[model samples]
Target: MQIIKAVYINEMFKISKKKKICTSLIFLLLSVIVAAIVVYSLNNFAGVSVTGSSEFSVMVLTILSYSLFPLFTAFICIDMFAGEFADHTIKFTLTGPASRLNVFLGKILAIATFIASNLIVVAVLSFLFSLFLNGGISNPLRIIISYIMAFLPIFIFALTVVLISNFSRGTTSAFMFSIFVFLVFVGLSVAFPQIKSFLFTSSFDWYKLILGSYINVGKIFRIFLILLGYGLMLFAAGYYLFEKKDI
Candidate 1:
């Protein structure tokens, strides 16, 4: 436990030193600014007042979940695994006192922490901006729940990226492969809606279940189980490869 904590802290420190983290923050701020502009235009020009706090946050989350979040996860996972391998820096980590399993868990936890932080920042920033535009939020609890629930699916996606990164020899290959796999699954879900519920990609919108007027506990539990299955399988597979790698 102590080793894992140490590794987690160390990994986070390493991630903090990366420029991508700053870039992600800048992109998020820009996205919020652009969203605010569009909302302003619609309200003034189109005469549509859709500047509700909850609604604004949802719109921003929709744009992010479908695009930025997944891409950022892929980039971070690639940097944590594939890029380390390419740079021959993974050896330093592997030579530490921590066991391979502990190291793996720490790294995964670090990525998850980063994702959660990003979600929090987006939620807070959007909510503050929404307050400026709309004066108050309608359902602050619902928006908070939505953002909290969102972490699961995105972390599952991160597990998928971690699995891909383990098998990739370079960051470029890892990123391309991750995007390809993501797009393929998304396409499959679109073409075959029947199986959409089972795909982790489709579950990215699982927050809708909570945000709905009537929350279906049973349905939410069923989807949670499916996502949990995917997360476990991906983690196991990723760790197996990580353990076997000649770092």
Candidate 2:
């Protein structure tokens, strides 16, 4: 299992590299770097100068966990599963020593690795640099918790993209369609905030789960369980389709 997992990870990165996706991955890295720079440079709030560092840190992490990092990752990963079929490698690869479940888990882990690592890097870099944000609590525990909290939303998102990829079978079009579908979903959900709790975006507010103080953490966990259940259902559906699919 370990060896196959390693090979799977290598193959995943190799695919990313060959597709020139690694270059784009720099944006994820750069976002973190930029956040750290912003936090360190303008800790004094520039003009207002009244809002404390905690406020700024919260704002920065919120943006990172919510809009910026997630949307960017969504773009990068929308093709994850479809790309395999696009390249005509799904059969040869999945029927190997790896089980279908392993394949799904492996692909998920690969995507999660990139997302989680980027979040961690951003959190650590921003946390260390946030020291300049005078009132920012340098509590290491909070920072760790913050990074862990960031992963939930990413997992929910990556799985969504992966599941969506099962429909199109081509990386480029699947990716494009996934984004279109996402926009439509967002638009409808926003138009009716009364039912917002049912939308993935509403539940994806992990930054609020940690950075904000109003919501109960238990509710956040419940939302995560819902997302996980959705992810598993998508994976099962995708796997069934793949098992009977003509490649």
Candidate 3:
């Protein structure tokens, strides 16, 4: 397992060095720059007297960092496993001592780690600029917690892509299903709140989820539990299919 993890981690670095990763990072940096400009300019123009925490600003930054950024990451994740198998590199890894189950898990972890790290970078950048533009960090801990919490759904969404990638018979099939799965999730997020749940992401974005105000601890716990459950369920299925695969 350790060797599998190390190899996967090394491969993750190689993937990160790819041109697409550079492009993606550039895109994220641009978003952050634009977001910062908007926040800074708005603060100066509105003359809203820098006083306490800029809850509104925090929320906006959260959306940029967690939601938009993670969505961008998903496009590349779909191609990760599928692309490997498409060119037959996956077979080389599969034939190694590590079971397909480990490969699947490691790949999922690699994706999750990549995304989580990206979110953390956003949080750091957002915090630095936020302090200067907003003039106060009323509760530093709260802002940080909110940023971390905002990425949970995205992490779950990414893992779903990994699972989908495994079941795909070929890269084309994986690509097609990836699109379907991505759209379905986005649609669910958009439509889930209309029926009953106020907790759905459709009702509120990252800003509303975080710095907009204080969410109850109970609600936070529930959200974490639900996401954790969903992530585990998807991973369990991925493992089941992988273990049974002829490869």
Candidate 4:
């Protein structure tokens, strides 16, 4: 436990010392600004009638979370994992007393922490922006539920990126490969409708479970199982590959 904690802290400190976190936050702020403008314009100028703050926030959050979060998380994971290996700084960490397993799990935890924090920040900002644009929150509970459920896809993407990072030889390779996979999934999800439900990317919009008029428990559970299975598989594969690598 202590070893894992040390690795987590070290990873966090290393990331904090870099500009990636700052860059991510800046992007989040820009996204919020852009979303706010669009939402406000649609309501005020375009004469679209929205329910209230919750609906406005949900619209913005859906777009940002579904699109931006995956891309942002992939880059972050690539920098954290593949960048270390590419620069050979991973050797320094591996040389420590902590076992590879502990280090690997710790890194995963660190990535999750970073992503969760960023998502929470964006959710808050989105809600506040909605309040500023609209009068009040229409369905606070539903928006909150949406925020929590959205993290499911973010973590799934993180795991996939980590696997790509571990398998690839360099940061560029990791980033490119991960992005390629992302695009492929997004493309396939749209291009092929029949198998959409089977694709993990299809399940990324799990937030719809809350937004819809009817909540299907069975469908939600199935999506949850699919995501959970994929996450475990990706994490296990990445860990195995990382363990086998001559770090």
User: lDDT of candidate 3 vs native?
Assistant: 0.65
Global lDDT scores for all candidate models: 0.90, 0.64, 0.65, 0.83
Quote each prediction's TM-score: 0.97, 0.79, 0.80, 0.94
What is the number of backbone collisions in each predicted candidate, taken in the order shown? 0, 0, 1, 0
Candidate 1 structure, TM-score to reference: 0.97
Top lDDT hit: 1
lDDT of 2 by residue, 57-79 (tens): 54566666556666656655554
**Candidate 1: C-alpha lDDT:** 0.90
RMSD of every prediction? 1.3, 3.3, 3.5, 1.7
Candidates 1 and 4, the one with greater lDDT: 1
- Model 2, residue 3: C-alpha shift (Å): 6.9
Question: How do the residues 54-149 of candidate 3 rate in per-residue lDDT, one tens digit apiece?
Answer: 553455554664356555655666666767766777677787787676777677777777777777777777666666766556777767666666
Q: Which residue pairs in candidate 1 collide? A: none
Candidate 2 is scored at a TM of 0.79
lDDT of 1 by residue, 31-66 (tens): 988898889788879988774434788878878998
Q: Report how far off residue 68 is in candidate 3 (Å).
A: 3.2
